[model samples]
Target: MRMLINVPETVVADGLRGLAAAHPDLTVDVENRVIVRRDAPVAGQVALVSGGGSGHEPLHGGFVGPGMLSAACPGEVFTSPVPDQMARAAAAVDSGAGVLFIVKNYTGDVLNFDMAAELAEDEGVQVAKVLVNDDVAVTDSLYTAGRRGTGATLFVEKIAGAAAAEGQPLERVESIGRQVNENSRSFGVALSACTTPAKGSPTFELPDGELELGIGIHGEPGRERRPMMTSGEIADFAVNAIVEDMPPRNPVLALVNGMGATPLLELYGFNAEVQRALRERGVAVARTLVGNYVTSLDMAGASVTLCQADEELLRLWDAPVKTPALRWGM
Candidate 1:
C-alpha cells in the first residue's frame, strides 16, 4: 500500500494539518486532536459532537461546521480518541445549552465517550449521548458488543445537528438522534481489505476471488464470505439482509456509501442496483446520497444505509449544512 503519508506516527497529525489548511472555518487543534467550528459555542444552541477512528476521513472531522457537528475529536487510525480529547471538544463547543455526544457502538468509542461525558459534566457542561449501532450485518463484532456503527452515523449526525442548530434543547436533540439510529440499518460488503499506515499492508487477507458480506469498517469479520458477485447480485444480498431485519415503514433516506477506495462511478452503478432491490421490496426512497461518507480506508466496497424518515425527519435532513465533505442548501 503506497499511501502518501510521510510516516505512520505522523499520519493523523499530518491529515489534521491539511484539514485545517483546507477549511479555515474549522479550528482544527492538531495538538489536542479536536476539530471545532470557528463560530462554535453558538449562543442558545445545543452543541453536537461526534468522533471515531481517523482513517475514515470526512467523517467526524470533515462533518464539522454549521448544521452538523459543532466539534469532533479524531482518534489515531482505527483507534478511539482519549476521553480528554472529547471532553475538550465538549467544553469548547458547549454554550450552556448542553452537548450531545453521537457515539458509535465500538467498544473503545463507547467507553471513551462515556468517560468524556463525565469529564465534561464535571466542568459544568451538561451532556447527553446517543449510540449509533445501525449495522444490522452482525450482532457482535471484534470492535463492538452490539452491531457496529457504520453509514448511519452520517444520518444521525446530519439530522440531529439540524435540530440542534434550530435551538432544540438537549433532550429533544438526543431524542431525534436516537430515533435516527433506531430507524436506520446498514449492511456492507468488502471487495478488498483496508490498509493501515502502520502496517503498510492490507489489514486482512482477502483472497482475489472472494468477498466478505456484511463487512465492518475496521475490516472485522462479517457474516460470511462468498465468491465475488456482480453489482446487482451484491445489491440483492445486502438489501435482502437489511429489509428482512427491519422493513421500511416510510419513505427512507438512502445512503449508498463507498468504503474508501470504491470510485464514484462504481458507487453510482451499485446504487442503481440498490434502488432496484429496494423497489422490489416495496421500499420508497425520500432521498439518496451516494459517496464515501463513512468509510474503511482504501477498502473496495460499499454499504447501504436506509433511514426510515417521517416528515419531520425529512425536513431536518433537508436542512442547510456546510462542511468540508458534504454541503448543500447553503
Candidate 2:
C-alpha cells in the first residue's frame, strides 16, 4: 500500500509511454499494449513474438529489437494478455516468411497464445509456436502439465531471435526455440513477496528471517518455506535442484536472474555461490550472465537457469543480438 505514484490506475499506461519514448526505434500500440520494432516484419525473416504479464519488465517488451522479438504484447500486471492483443501482435509482425510465438508454460499464457495462433492461421499467416516449460521445480512428463517456464524464456528469446535474424525459416527458428527449452532448466527462491500496482499490496506475506523455495514467477506458492539461509546455501538448494534434474555432462549457459528487488551486489554474490556449486558438481560453465533479465516485479528473489549447450547451441549463443535489454555485437 506504500507506493509512490500520482495516479495508480495509470501505472501500466504510464510505464508503456515511458518505454516508447525511451526507445523510439520501437513503436508502441498504446491501445493494445503491443510493442513492435519500428521496422517490423524484417522482410523475409521469420517474425518472433513473445509476451506475458506486464510486471516482469525488460522481458517481451524490452527485448523487442533487431536480434530479438519482432513484437511483444504486455498484459495486465501478473496476468496474461488476452487473445485479441496477441492476435494483433501476430498480425502486425507477420511477414510472408511467417511468425513464431514463444509462449511460457503458464496456464493463462498457453490458453491465450493458442487462441491467437489459431486466429492467425485462419488469417492465412503461417505460424509456429513453442511452449517453454523449463522450471525443474515442477515435475513434468506425459501426464503432468509440465514445468513452469521461468528464466529460460529469456534465453529462448535471445537465441531464437538470433536464428530468425539470420534468416532461418519459421520451422528452423521454432526448432531452435524448442531445443533451447528442452535443454534449459531453472529454479528460484523468494526472500520477499512483490506488490502488484493494481492490487496495491504485497501478493503474499513472508515473515522476517524466512524465504520461499522453488517459487514460481507469478508469486504462486512454492514447494517449501524455511528460515533464511546463507546466500551459498540458497544457491546450493537452487543449483542442486537444477543439477539433479539435468546432470552435468555438457557445457552450460548459466543465467543468474534477479526477481526484481534484489540488488546487483546480491545477485553477483549469489552468482559466485552458484558458480562454486557448479564447480563442485564438475559442470563446465560456457557462459555466465547475471542481471535482472527476468523478474517478478519487486520480489526479492533470484532464479538460476542452465542451458545444456552443445557446439551448435554455443554458436547460436554467441550470435550477435541487438535488443534494448540484451545487446551485444551490434
Candidate 3:
C-alpha cells in the first residue's frame, strides 16, 4: 500500500503543520495538537469543542471555524486524544459563558473527555458534555460500550455550533446537541479496508468481492460480510437498517458520506439510490448533503446518516458555517 508521507511517526504532526499553513484563520497548535478558530474566546458565547481520532479528516480539526467548532483536538490515527489536549482546548476557547464538549461515544473518547471536563471545571471554566452515540449498528462493539458514534457527529457539531454562535445558552446548546444525536441514525458499508499510516498493509483483511455491512470508522468488524451488492441494494440495506430501528421524523437532513477513497461520482450515484430508498420509506428530506465529511482515511466505502430535523433544527442546520470541509450560507 502506497501512502503520501515522509514517515508514519510524524503523519499527524505533519498534517497539522500543513493544515495550519493552509487555514490561517485557525490557530493550529502542532505541538499540543489543538486546532482553534483564530478568533476564539468569543464573548458571551458558549464555545463548542469536539474531537476524536485522526483518520477521520475534516472532522474535529477542519471543522474549526465560524459557526462550527471553536476548537478541536486531534489524536493519532484511530486513537483518542488525551485529556490534556481537550482541557487545553476548553481552557483556550472558554469565555465567561462556558464551553460544550461534543464527544463521540468511543470508550477512549468518552473517558478522556470526561476527565477533560473535570479539568476544565478545576480551571474555573464551566463545561457541558454531549455524547454522540448515533450509530444504529450494535449496542456494544469493540470500540464502545454502547452504540458507536459515527456520522451523527457532524450533525451534532453543526446544529450545536449554530446554537452557540447565535448566543444560545450553554444549557440550550448542549440540549440541542444531544437532541441532534438522538434523532440521527447511521449505517456504513465497506468495499475495501483502510490502511493507517503506522501500518502499510490493510488494518483488516476484507476479501475482495465482499462487503462489510455496518462498518465502523476504524475498520472494525461490521455486523456481517456478504457478496458485493449494487449501489441501490446497498442503499436499501443501509436505509432499512436505520429506519427499522428508529424511524426518522417527517423531514430529515441526509448526509451521504464517503469513507475516503470512494469518489464523488460513485457517492453521487449512491446518493441517488439513498434518496430513492428514503422516498420509498415515505421519509421527506429537508436537505441533502453529499460528500466526504466524516471519513475513515482511504477506505472505499460510504455511510448514510439521516438526521430527523424539526423546524428549529432545520433553521440551525441551514445557518452560516465557514469550515474547511463544510461550508454553506457563509
Candidate 4:
C-alpha cells in the first residue's frame, strides 16, 4: 500500500521516460518505448534485440550498449510488448548483416516477437531468433511451455551481443545463443509478493514465516509453499534442483539473483550457500555473480542460475561488455 509516485496507467511509458532521462547516451523511442544504442544500425554487424515487461529493471533496456543489445522494447509491468513496437525496434536496428531477436520462453513474448520478425522480414530485413527456456522447475513438457526463462537471460544477452558486436554471422550468433540456453538452468524462491502499481497491493500474501518455491519472475505462484527456512536450507533446495537437472560435473557460470527487495547481504549469504552446495556435489564453479539481475518488481525472493561452461562459453564470458548494468574492459 505504500509506494512512491502516482500509479500511471501505462507503466511502460512512465518507466521509459525515467530510463531515457537516466541514460541520455541511449536513444529512446517514446512512441514505441524501445531503447536503442544512441548510434544504431551499426554497419555490417548483426543487431541484437531483446525485450520483455517493465518491472525487471536493468534487464532488456539496462543491457543496451556497445557490447550487448542494439535495441530493447519495453512492455507494461508483467506484460509483453506489442508486436508493432518490436517491429519498429527491429527495423530501426537492422543493418546489412541482419538482426537477431532474443526472446524469453513466455507465451506472449514468443507470440509478439514472432509477429515482429515476420513483419521485419516482410520489409526485406533478415532476422534470426533464439528462444531461452532455461528454468528447470517447470515440467509437463507436453502440456506446459516447458521451463520459464529466468536469470540466464543476462548471460545470453552479454555473450550473444558480444558475438554480434564481433561481426559473427546471424546464424552463428543465434546458434551460440541456443547453446547457452540449453546449458543453463534456474530456480527461484519467494518470501513476499510484489505490488503492481495499478493493483495497489501485493499480488499475493505470504505469511511472515512462509516461502514460495520454484517462483517465476512475474510474481507468479511457485510450485510449492512452506514455512520459511534458513538461507542454507533454501540454497540447498534451489541449487540441488538445478544441479540435479543438469550435468553435475560441468563447470558453471553461477548467478544468485535477488528478486528485488532482498538486500545484498542476504544475496551474498545465499551465494555462499550456493557455493557450498555446489562444492558438496563436486561441481566446478567457474565464475560467480550475485545481484538483483532479473526482478519481479519489489518482490522479496531470489533465484539461482547455473550455465554449464566450456572453453568457448568461457571465452565469450571473458569478452568485453559495456552496458548500463554490466560494464568491463573499457
Candidate 5:
C-alpha cells in the first residue's frame, strides 16, 4: 500500500505531533497520547472526554476544544486506547463538576473506558459514561456486541458537550448524551476498503461494480455486498433504513458523512439526494451537515446519520463550539 509514513508504529504518534503543531488552542500529551484543550479543568464545568481508535481524523482528536470534548484519548489505528491513557486524561481535565466519558459501543473502548472511570472514581473524581450505539446498520459486529456507534457519536459529543459547558450537572450531561444516542441512527456504504499503515494493504477487498452496505468506521464488514447502483438509489437505501428506525416526521438534524476518500463534490450531490429522499418521506430536515467528519482511513464511501431533534436538542446543538473540525457560533 502506498502511504506517507516513516514507520507503521510511529504513524499515530507522528500524526498527534502534527495535530498539536497545527492547533495552538489544543495541547497534546505525546507520551500519553491524549489531546486536550489548552486551558482545561474549567471551573464549575463538567469535562467531556471521548475517544476510540485512530484513523478517523477530525473525530475524537480534532474535536478537542472549548465547546466539545475537553480531552480525547485516541488509540492506535483501529486499536482501542488503554485504560491508563484515559485515566490520565480524565485526571487532567476533571474540574470540580466531574468528568463524563462519551464512548462508542465498541467492546474494547467500552472496557477500557470503564476501567478508567473506576480508577478516576477511586481518586475521588466523580465519573459518568454515556455509551453511543446509534448505528442501525447491524445489531452485532466483530468489534461490538451490540449496535456499532457511527456518525451519531459526533451528535452526542456536540449536544452533550454544550450542556456540560453550560455547567449542567454530570448526570444531566450524561442524560443528554444518552438521549442523543437514542434519537440518532446511522447507515454507511463502502465503495472501497481502507488500508492501514501497519497492514500495508486494504482492510477488505471489494471488486469493481459492487458496494458494501452498512459498514463500520473500522472497515468492518457491513450487512451485505450488493451490486453498485445510482447515487439516488444508494441514498434511498440509507434514508429508508434511518426513517424506518426513527420515522422522522419531526424536525431532524441530518448528516451525510464521507468515509475518508470520497470527494466533497460527490458528497454534496449525495447530500442533495438524501435531503430529497427525506423530504419525499415527509421528514423535515431542520439542519444538515455534509463532510468527512468520521472516517475510515482512505475508504471510499459515505454514511447518512439522522438525529431527531426537539427544541432542547436544537438549542444545545446551536450552542457555541470552537474546535478544529467544527467551529461555529463562537
Candidate 6:
C-alpha cells in the first residue's frame, strides 16, 4: 500500500495529533483516543457525543464543536471504538444536564455504545442513545441488522446538537435526533473501491464500465453491480430509491455527498441532476448540500440523502454551527 504514513499501526494516532494541531479549539485525549471540544461540559446543557471508525474523517471528529458534537471517539480504520474510550469521553463532557450518544446502526457501534452508556450511568452520569439508520439501501448488511446509517448521521448530529446547545433537556434532544433519522433516507453508488491504510489494497474490486449500487461506507458489497450508465439515469435511480423508501414530503433537505475521491465539480453536476430528478417527483429541494461530508476512504462515487423538513427542522439546520468540517452563520 502506497500511503503517506510512518507506519500502519500509528495512522490513527498520527491523524489525531494532526487534527489537534489544525484546530486549536479541539483537544485530543491520545491515551483514551477521544476528541473533545475545549470548552466541554457547558453548564446546564445536554452534551452530544458520537464516534465510529477513524477512516471517515471530518465525520464524528470534524463535526465536534459548537452546535454539533461535544466529544467524538474514533477507533482504528473501519473499527468501532471501545467502551472505555466512550465512557471516559462521556464522563469528561457530561454537564449536570446529561449526555446523548448518537450511535450509527452498526453491530459493533451499537454494542460498544450500549456498554459505554451503562458504564457512564453506573458512575452517576445520565446518558441516552439515538441510533441513526437512514440508509435505505438494504434491510440487513454484514455490519448491521436493519438499515445501515449513512449520510443522515450528519443531519441528526447538526439538528440534535443545535437542540442540545439551546439547553434543551436530554429527552427532548434525543427525540429530535430520532425524528431526524426517521424522516431521512439515503442511497449510494460506487464507481471504485477504497484502499485502507493497513491493508494497502482496494477493499473491493470493480471492473471498468461497472458500478456498485447501494454500497456501504465500510467497503461492504453493495446490493448489486450493474453496467455503468449515464449520470442522469444513475441520479434517477438513486433519488428514486430514497423517494420510494420515504417519499419526499416536500420542503426536503437533499444532500449529494461524494464518497472521498469524486471531485467537487462532478458532485455539483450530480447535485443539479438530483434536484431535477426530485422535482420531477414533486419534491421541493428546500436546502441542498453537495460535497464530501461522509466518505469511504478514497472511494470514487456519491450518495444522496433526503430529509423531509418542517419549519422546526429547517430552522435548527440553519442554526449557527462551528466545526472543522461544517461551519456557518457563526
Q: What is the C-alpha RMSD of each candidate to the true structure, in Å?
A: 0.6, 2.1, 0.7, 1.7, 0.7, 0.8
lDDT of 2 by residue, 187-286 (tens): 9999999988777778889998999998888777787899999999998999899988888777999999999999999999999999999999899999
Q: lDDT winner among the candidates?
A: 1
How many Å off is the CA of 126 in candidate 3?
Answer: 0.4
Across residues 1-330, which tens digit of lDDT does each residue of candidate 4 receive? 777665658567777788888888799987768899988999988999999978898888999988889999988888888888888888888887888999988888899999999999999889899898888877523223767888989989988888888899999999989988888999999999998888888888889999999888877778889998899999999988897788675799998999999999999999999999989989999989899889998999899999988988888888887778888885
Clashes in model 4: which pairs?
none
Which lDDT tens digits does candidate 1 get at residues 1-330?
A: 678879899999999999999999999999999999999999999999999998898898989999999999999999999999999999999999999999999999999999999999999999999999999899987888988989999999999999999999999999999999999999999999999998888988999999999999998888999999999999999999999999779799999999999999999999999999999889999999999989888999999999999999999999999999889999
Record all residue pairs in model 6 with backbone atoms less than 3 Å apart, i.e. clashing: none
- Model 2 residue runs over 4 Å out of place are 139-144
The runs of at least 3 residues in candidate 5 whose Cα sits more than 4 Å from the true structure, single-residue gaps closed, are none
TM, every model: 0.99, 0.96, 0.99, 0.97, 0.99, 0.99
* Models ranked on lDDT: 1, 3, 5, 6, 2, 4
Candidate 6 or 4, higher TM-score:
6
RMSD of 2: 2.1
Error of 1 at 327 (Å): 0.6
Candidate scoring better on TM-score of 2 and 3:
3
Cα lDDT, model 1, residue 241: 92
Report the C-alpha lDDT of model 6 over 1-330, residue by residue, as the tens digit: 658899889999999999999999999987789999999989988999999998887788999999999999999999999998999989989997999999999999999999999999999999989999999888899889999999999999999999998999999999999999999999999999999988998998999899999999989989899999777888999998998888667799888999999999999998888988998999998899888988988899999999998999999999999999999999
Q: Give the CA lDDT, 0 to 100, for residue 272 in model 5.
A: 88
Candidate 2 clash pair list = none
Q: What is the lDDT of residue 43 in candidate 5?
A: 96
- Candidate 4 matches the true fold with a TM-score of 0.97
Model 3 residue 324 CA deviation in Å: 0.6
